[model samples]
Target: MKQQLPKNFKPKALAALIGLTFTLNHASTIAQEAEPETALETITVTAQKRTQNLQEVPVSVTAFTGDEMAEAVIKDMYDLQTNVPGLGAFQSQSATNSSFSIRGVGTSSQNFGLESSVGLYVDGVYRARQNSMINNLVDVAAVEVLRGPQGTLFGKNTPSGAILVSTVTPSHDGGDSFVEATVGNYGLVNLSGATSISAIEDVLAFRVTAFGSQRDGTIDSVGNGSETGKNLLNDRNRWGARVQALYTPNDDVSVRIIADYADIDEICCGAPVQLSNATINPDGEIGSDLALPLLGGTVFAGGDAFYDREVAVSFLPESTMTDKGLSAEVDWELDENYTLVSISAYRNFESFDNIDTDFTDANLFGTYNDSKQSSFSQEIRIDYTGDNLNYILGAYYFTQDLDLDYSLYTDTFFNEFYMSSLGGALDDLFAGINAISAATGGAVAPVADAAPAGTGFDHQAKQQHESYAVFGQFDYELSDTLTLTAGLRYTDETKDLVTIFSENLADGSQSPEFFNSTTELIIGAGAAGVAAGNIGAALAGGQAPSAEDLAALLPFQTAGWGFQ
Candidate 1:
């Protein structure tokens, strides 16, 4: 007979007998009339650079432990808004375009030169860019959201608020591990795991953690192309990993190091156009009457009659991001009442987005952005604790380099539509000129060919930024229930940006006739001492020329309409 492993076995209850004996022996000594006492658990937070009871901190702050976050299924920065009051978070076409607001104060612009008013810090190291702030939370120990201005304590840009994230540290006594998996609708799958080990008993330890999630798109893409009949909008595909190490050779000093990386590649972010009661033409026709024909008879589906979660596109939208960073923190106890700390970090982030600007299958226009940023920062602080006084002093230095290459382009369908419109407008212009010539007895010129097709431009921008600050905060206890708190910060910053624009056409061809006709009309009218308004009235029949129209015409006079 083959040997078989035991499938089910019960061990003897040895602990129960031991417990019974101990209880019998201690029954006479124990007091049966005493009632157990209970008290609320105290929560400790580090919002002021030192640990303190949450109820004792004077700042307007909210904190959540890792267990609370896991119980609530908080996975990333976007999920914090649902649980935190007076906080708003939104991700636009990509992670790089994310926005975070605290009490209705935040930065929403996507300009490469701007910084967020609400600062984000992980392990006491600043995450200067929006892309760096959207990574999945892995092995998080605690999160603290501080409302109102925190410029003195956090430094950099924190005029609105600040978010602080602390990751679990590697412990000398290890043997910690866990694995979790979750599944949901729309083919969603999430998996994460973490493990810790001690390499040198009391001197060194290390921990490794990883997480990933993916879900199918919620919106449908319906078009006459290969992408038709596919759920290709608003999908999720991302993964990340982190490694941490701790070292404490003696009782007075400790060091922690962390390295992390994350990636996101997904087809995302387009909304259906609602045409109900929408106007698109000067004659006040409904938007669908003018837009549906242009979309080649594409119809909306999946929800209401006029509004739904369906998008029609000739090209699918795409967004991808890569974020990686390394940080080191050191803490040393100088004496019984003073401690010194230092944090140094370096990060690199890159994101690319291809979006359909027109939100239709007409292929009118599209935008592409390729951006990269590299940053380095250093902070040093010293803490002083006395019987009735506590204070912290710190200095921070940061530098970054950013590069953006942007392009806007049109296709054949857009070129054809533009040429047709340009031809009709030219016809009307020549008719007015002919009538003027008949009245003035001057020569009438024939209309010219429409301007060159497939017009587009490309530009590359580079920015360098550097900043440094010295900040300090102090608190003094005046009595048992009263305290005085004061803080100050002085910061200096500088930035430099340079942009280079490419020629309109790759072949560098010129449309001289197109420029000549338009420029001649404007210059001839101007040379005759006619006012700009009169020139506009004579050419357009009544309306004054808009600033944009005049700007477009002014460049053609000398530069010949070439983007330089």
Candidate 2:
């Protein structure tokens, strides 16, 4: 082009050639200007109440998006083990009852009356109960695992760590719908879908997501091979749905209304194979009493006595769980430097189980637990953002009403230990009576059999609790490279409880209704004709066990539990 166009050439021709050359070279220039998108993108997290790059946060956290979880095939809380380091999940008979551990530290207690060491949350809502937190995850936006103590900001003071579940919020821009179905072995059927509609363009949006799954049992439960019982020690029938509404009135205000419900019905909980009875060993070291030989005579001997798919349980069992909740969250931009947020929620949880406790096909032992709980919480917070300081301050009020109906039924079959104690008491009483008769030089009423060697009991209880707290956290950018953080919380709480305990005779040969009938076993050691004395001595000073006296024992549980 050294001899290109002459200075007097047609302006149009020169312009067209230059334009063509520019177009041909534009792509090459773009290629030189644009860098490859190969570098990993940094994740943003709100674990600290402030948006920041994941790597920049001072806490140890692992984050995953909904797409990432889908790619990894993580469908529920238990599936979190796939990526969380130092974490473990034990899939029990019921998915809701699954256990989670972090660095081998987790609460082994499954008592509904207690709180967990690890905290679980959904969209900034604390799931106080683990049973309610184990439901199938719905269209999640992201999941964050915060390792170590997060007491300053979260609802509960979780020393073990926190599992934060952030579900996808209703979008204001578009509409989309998807449905998926999966079929697998053991009759596994899973169906999931979600739909979103911008009901009023930029002003209102609604989203609904739901899932249903059912699977065959892990063990072949014989179900007592009868009419009243069901297949035991199996998987669960589970389903859940979530609905959310997003309202945006201009750019300065936003509100979200959410409601969710989950229901599960299945037989669960398989007892471990008893190696031996509880006693000193055969080497005269420890008895067999502590280790009853459960599978010593099973087909698989010398190896793991119990079969992989064979639990060998013979009984009818029932297990069911229901969880439902509703919540609302509001965000108001006070200005460019401040924002106000309010989260109000109410939730209910209940699980009922009628199970065989002896782990055998025998009808000797059984237990029924009817647990119900209702809880409500309200939180209002103000967050500040400035060049020199950032902070979050909130006032929280939380209250929960709990009702636990627990009953244990067992015949004389497994009450041998208690019966032996009863026997010893009878023997001592007989000796005392003989001694009295000889000393008084009088004839005593001759007695042959004291009473049938059987014992049982019935227990019922109720609990209530209310708690309130005011908490605040402050972070100051003292300097560009150094920051200071501090926080504090104050709480006020009250609790009320009432429990009733009664004695009843063993009910093996009697009707199932007779199991709860309290007409037989003597109350307490006083009326049992034990070593202390007989009827005469008992009536002299002993206050026999009565319904009226049980009120004093109802508040046995600790009044104030630790942080959430």
Candidate 3:
């Protein structure tokens, strides 16, 4: 599916074509009239961890240079994925969360602890999480997307593929600066630019770049005091900056250091619900539809109608994300045919999400969540190239600390769960009581009373992962048109994790009034109600349901809720 990035990602590169219309026409005419064997633009990439001609590599790789990407208006990883065949990237239920897939292989959504199927690397240093890879695409250099499993070369988490990104190095050329801005409908505003300068000519150079964009959100959040425009839900606001320093003290040695930070705040991912006549939930139970009549059912956001981009949520929406990193790379020429390389990097990222989950104007359910990932990686490698043989060997070490916590709240879950949990008991009690009223020629119903049974989730988990690997790869040219390639890696990994999950009633417990009503409803149901006795006696006898009782009564409630 070629889904256009939501309205927020629209490109403003139209200005680049301003003075090229006639020139391009002339170039096209001349090229078409020239020799059939005219040369094409050359594209170079480091997909194999070395500079190489794109056509010479056997692996399936797509390479785009920094200049080419800017010209093509590819702003970020998500935009890059849109142009690649066999690549899929989409925002998950939260703006701060996203998923990627290549060639039908993809990572599941919002599973913070699971490793990505595709690996991500910046300047040869591996990144621990994919969420940290999508933003702040600035500076220079290139990106190489290698398809299929990079089993040996990249090590773990590459069963699907790998993405290699390189930022531009300091240039010795004279400095240049420019400012560009785009304003469009729907309050779309984008501004970005860069400046590069040489402090000591060929000896040292530095660059600074920044980008920011803001636009009206996609979904309109209405009802429950939601402002029509000021507090619009699903809005987009993001900005980031990067600075780089490059040093080349001698012809055989070069070093580059990069530091960057990015932040985003937005109300994103508004999910609306639609009503259906289906009689059952996927579990084969009569489902919540069975309780719809009693609960009065959910009210659609548009008051019985669903309009385009309209969402109703009783809870406010919010999402915040931040990323920071530092990296250093050095290349040293040891001799004529040999070279040494080292890459070290550190990164920290955090995201917070507040979502209105019930998908209605009524207060029902929602969630507050946070995830943080910080990691460090170091690698050193030696390269040798010869007429018939080329090889590289490297050692890598990586470590990470991850923390995630989620709080899921449901204001109406008590009714839903209790109905599902004590369906027979409630029916037994209420049936008899209603029958008693029926004999008096009157009907009685439930009120805003009793122990509402909703249980929320409080989960906090910590995970520590450490990995080390030694790997080598070689390529041999047997003849003019024949070649051989082989690679191997020895790896060790250790991981430790702990998580805590609980669910409880909103009213705290079986309040006395709730018990009285419950007993009365049971009595109304006839036989079973009479045997249960007065509410006081049953309660005093410790007859309230226990966690074990709930386990047996509400099988679906076993999942999670409460504090960890």
Whole-model lDDT values for every prediction: 0.69, 0.61, 0.65
lDDT-sorted candidate list, best first: 1, 3, 2
lDDT of 2 by residue, 414-532 (tens): 43333343556445544554553454353333222221223234556677877778778888888877789888877787778777766444433321221122233233223324422
Q: Residue 229 in candidate 2 has what lDDT?
A: 23
- State the number of backbone clashes in model 1: 0
Predicted candidate 1 versus true structure: per-residue lDDT over 1-564, tens digit per residue: 111112332222211211000011110111123334675566778888788777788878888877677767788887787799877776665445777789999886377668888888988989878666776786788888989988888887888899988887786544446676767666777787777779998889898888898877766777652286545677889999999998998899999999999999888675443331123422343454454456353544322333434567767788898999999999999999999999999999888988776666765667788999999999999999999999999999999999999877655455445544444534444454345445434432322223233555677999999999999999999998998999999999999999987645424653333334656645643432233334446555644444553443343232223222
Better of 1 and 2 by lDDT: 1
Q: Where in model 2 is the C-alpha error above 4 Å?
A: 1-40, 90-99, 173-176, 222-232, 273-300, 304-307, 415-456, 478-480, 505-564
TM-score of 3: 0.77
Q: The CA-based lDDT of model 1 is what?
A: 0.69
Model 2's C-alpha root-mean-square deviation from the true structure amounts to 17.6
Kindly report which residue stretches of model 3 are placed more than 4 angstroms away from their true locations once superposed.
1-37, 175-177, 223-231, 272-307, 412-455, 504-531, 534-564
Cα lDDT tens digits, model 3, 72-102, are 7776787898677787776755676676778
